[model samples]
Target: MKISEFVKQVNTTKDAVRHYEELDLLRPSWKNDVRYYSPKDVGDFHAIKEMQSVGFSLKDVQAIFNLKRTDGCGSEKLIQGFLDSLDKELEAVVKAEEELQQKKSKITNMILELKQL
Candidate 1:
């Protein structure tokens, strides 16, 4: 399919698709100055969006993708790198959750004190 159909199928904007292409995340085939997207491209687009949904920045996603592509799927180094990234992200999320809980507790205490006044 072409860019139009691909965008419709993916339920995303053309500019988003173009941006992904610019980032080398999406590689549609070119023929006579026109780009043609395959089903695999659609799958890649969904994978990119899924990664973004889980707090992966485009740069992070690109690095992960590049690592897989460069090192191949079965490379132990790639698996270890991916695990390291996930561990870092998990730690950050846990820290953020703790901070949020603390803030919520502080706000609750302030509200209770205000009620006494």
Candidate 2:
């Protein structure tokens, strides 16, 4: 499909899609300067969106995509790298959650002390 259809199908702005193309993150088959996206591109679009949602920077996404292209999706090293990134992210989230919970507990204790006065 054309860029318009591709953007609509992927539920993303044309500018964002263009930016992805410019970043070498997403590529559609091109002919005469026109881009045509295959149905399979839908999966690619979802994958990109998913990565972005999980706090993966465009550069990180690009690296993963490059690895997949060069070594195939089933490559153990690529899978390990992805898993490592996720693990790091998870650790950060867990730490943040712990800090927030501690803050909440402190606030609750303060409120209880004020009520006792």
Number of the top TM-score candidate: 1
Question: How do the residues 47-104 of candidate 1 rate in per-residue lDDT, one tens digit apiece?
Answer: 8998787688899889888987899966887888778877888898999999999999
lDDT of 2 by residue, 22-63 (tens): 988777998998999988777888998998898788888998
Residue clash pairs of candidate 2: none
Q: What is the TM-score of each candidate against the true structure?
A: 0.93, 0.91
Cα lDDT for residue 14, candidate 2: 91
- In order, candidate lDDTs are 0.91, 0.88
